[model samples]
Target: MSALAPAVPRRTPLDSFAGTWHLTRFMLRRDRVRLTVWTVSLLALYAYFVTALSALYPAAEDRQGRAALMEQPASIFLGGPNYGLDDYTIGAMFANEMTLWMIGLLGVMNMFEVVRNTRAEEESGRAEMVRSGAVGRHAAVAASLLTVVFANVVFALLGSALLITAGGLAVADTFALSTAIAVTGLVFAAVALVTSQLTTHGRGATGLGLAVLGFAVLVRGIGDLQAEPGEHGTWLSWLSPIAWAQQMRAYVDLRWWPLALSVVAILVLLALGAFLASKRDFDGALLTGGSGRAEAPSMLSNPLAMSWRQQRIALFWWFLGTFVMFGATGTYLGEGVEDMVDDIAGSNPEAAKMFGDDPLTGFLAIMILYAALAAAGYAIATTLRAKNEEADGRLDITLAKPVSRGRWFAAHLAVVAFGAFVLTMISGALALWAGALVNGEVELATFLKGGAAFLPAVAVFMALTAALYAWVPKITPVVWALFAFTAITGMFGPLFDLPDAVAGISPIWWVGRYPQEPIEPSHMIGLSVVAAVLLVAAFVGFRRRDITS
Candidate 1:
């Protein structure tokens, strides 16, 4: 009896990682469609860019000229740092044209994926149910990270293979380039994991991660824009994970040390997230930011008003980014519009045509298109809120009251449509004012015309999203797919040599290139008609469909 002493529990490295593999499989099963679609689509897009570039710039001089133009300030701001721009190969052009944008896109995808699997599940109460079993505290986070890493690896292998074999890129350059892209995505994935631990709401977690991304892009742009040609040091690009990918200089020097910096950052973030997860309760957030208002306001009594209240924060961020980032673009172009326009025209004939006579107005036109896309994104997210609410069993309570399906749905659609209109105007006005201030002239008419040009396109997307929400609620995510298809085709169609028939499917294509070309009143009228039809159909469908929880 005396010899029977206290026993210590034995733990191994695997103990901390217990259930990670099973959880990973479960997450994969849950998100298979999403994961597969994202991976294949991204890889195909990357491959298309590489393949198209080789055909577009078959001549060596053509490649060199395009590469030099990429070194311009506007290019660096629009596309991240263009490494190896002097190299006479498609790989270098691909690095310049696609790397930064791809990094940003992949960062966003990683953020949403990590947050959806971790914080979103926890918020929805599914995570607690899973954790109640034999799952370890760290398993969910670990599984999410590992799954993302695996996806990135798959993307790198497929993307690099395409570049090497199809595009005839040097093996070393392709390897380095692909690794840089993968590592950039991993950094954001880790950031999302840390954010998921800190924020109670999944949207907050996403916003925190994207805010970091925005800050990094801004720092890298400012740093590179100011640094002298072939200059280094004292620039914030050295500190941005996105910039670190370009600093690797895939085709030129194949510098790999910057990746070590990313590795260090990722490890530190993962460790911090694990520690925080262990310290907090199962469903608790480390940063709750206190409670909301004790009672609902009178304004919130209306479904339309409530929708606005729910979406105001997201709209605020979009408006801020559009105002600052797009406005900064205008400011940069204003310093020497003629030179910038000529440089851009020399590189891209389609852009030259789109910009037309007044370079400022032309630039504003391009910004308007981007702003319209952002507005569409806001609308899509807002429309999808119905799905979220329904899944959370909140929609039933509202429906059980006096709320008619049509009225409730119409209220959401109205809010989304109205918000997009306001945000687009705000973005356009700010960009116009900034550009005017720099050029020593202000033209309110130009701002109004340019900003209003894309509203029809934005409305079409909003209406499309509403239709999806009404008729095919289960496949509402496909609206994003449609949006992506249009965005990719519209943005890269010329470069990729895609047929007009294929590119014409996007509503963006219908928004005739403005300022350079006259606005098409007939086309705008048609878009408006289409939007109205979609909304009417959506309302009818919503009334007849079963509202599921």
Candidate 2:
């Protein structure tokens, strides 16, 4: 019988996804708190925007005036194409003004979630351990993708429900916008999956994913700017998934066709990611790094220098990102400042009171606050790097050398401090430069002072993160929760008519909205003192504790 043909195994198409559902459940359990926080924060943001808009523009004329203000080049560049501007309703305004921003935020969340589960797991060696069990070759990637998809769906459903109930928005329109947001998030998750296959490290995968996101934003912005006022963007916008979400045009002649583009892109990317995964070996990457030098660099001789070397790439990306975003925003300050301020002041007295008299200064103060928030984010991430090192057993190895625990911890803190200050200053300088190019009246010194004024507040957050990492390493993530609380309070307290005692809880609030309101010395000194105390606590705690890893 032809030597009894060797029994050949029959492979089903779904064989590669054998343990996908099991792994997906495991991921859900692992990321329960993280997913909950993300979902809640996004929903709260949507609610805040809707509430603020309702209060800011009670009449059709107010909404129309806001739309006219948004017609300027800078607004269009930052916002969406000028859809529904002719007779802009509140729903239409939400669709045009908020959709792109929400999409961008969701895209970041999805990309990080995907990379954290897939590439980060592999880098930490846990993925190999899991695969050695009953898991199939593509089970981990499938599980990550599934988990992210579930999160997006939950966000879409809850967000749509909130809009319909809270804002009394049309059911159809709310669903359309929420669906766009969810689908856009899926596209980025797929992009991250493909990127994870390309790079061996989690950070590399995340950077590649963010680079694609940035490119999409740029293309969409250019396309929108190239279009005539009060019209849809040119075909270039059609190439971007972001633009696809925006072009759904919820509440403004809603079109469902654009979402088809997003769905197709997601499918293509997911397939490519799977094919690449099949081609690569476990714990391997399609894009390999170059060989290392024979000798160590001089910069590796000291702990501080080594910390700087590890963090420089992230710092560069932060600077570049802030430069482009703030510069674009600065360009809008020139001619549109007066009309924009007037619209806010005329419709919403609370907003007017917050902005103060000088429109330019008031606007710059708000922008600087945003810049400070970004700097604080950088600080928190840098601070957490120290904890990651300890958890990965690197700290134990380094400590075995002549390096002291306090010194090693302090080295990371120094990098965080330097990076925060540099990022704040760069943001302030670029905004002034870009505004001057258009307005010609922006005072560089005033903007710089505005940036500097927030440094103490930024330091407070960095120090808080360090303290958390030192004492309660397991709860270090609470710093992000604290950040979210502060962000909501500081950004929306005035609009919400929150009590002074409650608003004062945010460190940023104590700074008194610089340039709009004069910076108080007492507040700055208090914040500095708090930061110093926290740093001392971090050093003491870190020195006393045993290295866990």
Q: Give candidate 2's error at residue 211 in angstroms.
A: 1.1
lDDT of 1 by residue, 215-262 (tens): 888888887787777774235778788788888877767888988988
lDDT of 2 by residue, 1-549 (tens): 458878889988788888999999999999999899888989998988887778777777777767876876667877768678888887888888888788888999999999999999999999989988877888889899999999999999999998998788999989999999999989999999999999989989999999899889889989989987556898887788998888887887888998898999999999999899889998899999788798888778799999998899888878877887788777756554666766666666666665667655676677788888889888998889888788888889999989888888888899889999988888655554575467556667777888888899999999999998888899998888878877877665666677888777778988877777888999999999999999999899888878886
lDDT of each: 0.78, 0.85
Residue ranges of candidate 2 with Cα displaced over 4 Å: 1-8, 497-499
How many clashing pairs per prediction, in order? 0, 0
Q: For candidate 2, what is the lDDT?
A: 0.85
Candidate whose TM-score is highest: 2
